[model samples]
Target: MTDLQQNYAHVYNNSVGFGRYPCLILIDFAQAYFDPDCPLYAEVDSALASALRLRKTAQTANIPIVLTKMTYDVAGVTGGRFFEKAKPLEAFLPGRATGEFAKGLVPQPTEIVVEKQYPSAFFGTSLASTLICLGCDSVLLTGLTTSGCVRASCVDAMSHGFRTIVVADACGDRHDAPHQANLFDMKAKYADVVSEAAALEHLATLVTRG
Candidate 1:
């Protein structure tokens, strides 16, 4: 297994670095993932902390920010097949407190809030268009469940012609194995999995230029 991973890196060793315009996309940092009583509780407080730090940097740099939350119609019809496949999604049903952003991660009024019913934020939403309209050439993605919505959004962001940068420290999952594996996979193919310090340094450049 180790040998194959090394071989794949040689095969897919290409990097799409940060672009001139970047938007920080915070995906599904919902209270459900932080609440102990919820099935989706990830117990990844540190990842949430890293995301908050990045959010502050993005704001200071005047970068566009987009926050996404999973939501479904009261009857769950909006979630479609994904909802049926993942029963834990009930936590995101309308008016449920678990659907709200986690304590330290609230969207400012000027930031965009995209309510998505599917795993990929761009699947049935205006995310791609919104980013394009904002003149964004890159996506700085962070959020819960690195192997799930974060991975999905990374791929979709790339497909939509944006360079996707996944902040490694800012993405959490139910367990470390999936989180690490998914981060490896994304860095190899879809997105650039980068550290919080690296992301902050990049944002610092933007601030200096302005």
Candidate 2:
């Protein structure tokens, strides 16, 4: 193991296995993150592809899906401090195509879509209550900007008493450094970080027994 890995090995290395009922939460997989011309673009095409596959698997298993998108009023009235700090958030203002959910992975009519003005979907949103209402014991997270929204959502999910699982290959950042670093930190401190393949395998088991 690398020296850094060895150092953290003794500290934050606990796995929270999947629970009886798990829901998939896709955080901010909006067009802005995929559009090459957008400043918020994160080179997340691979992540989006993996998320599409994961979504199909979850749908077949009859698992609940929750999607989140960053949205704000034209004048940024609701976004407040977060909007001020991150000027790039302007891309999500009303009428901006960047704020819309990516085409292929749009939430179905029965699925939940929580529009928020902040990073964590749980913050100022009904996500926690909605998860409870759905009887979800765990959350499988997939989305963009690993160091930002994805990390925040994972931490909030864990805080809400859900076994948070971050699909490593299904989440991306503009650069590898933050993406990898956040994944390592999340795996150690906040949530279980698993590959998309592993998550799909677990979901398949659910489908088989049901």
Clashing pairs in 1: none
lDDT of 2: 0.91
The digit string of per-residue lDDT tens for model 1 on 42-95 reads: 878998899899989899999899999898899899988889999999999989
* Alpha-carbon local distance difference test for all models: 0.92, 0.91
True-structure lDDT of candidate 1: 0.92
Give the lowest summed-lDDT range of ten residues in model 2: 101-110
Top TM-score hit: 2
For model 2, what is the alpha-carbon lDDT of residue 184?
Answer: 95
The candidate scoring highest on lDDT is 1
lDDT of 2 by residue, 79-138 (tens): 999999999999999999998988797679978999988889899999899889989999
RMSD, every candidate, angstroms:
1.2, 0.8
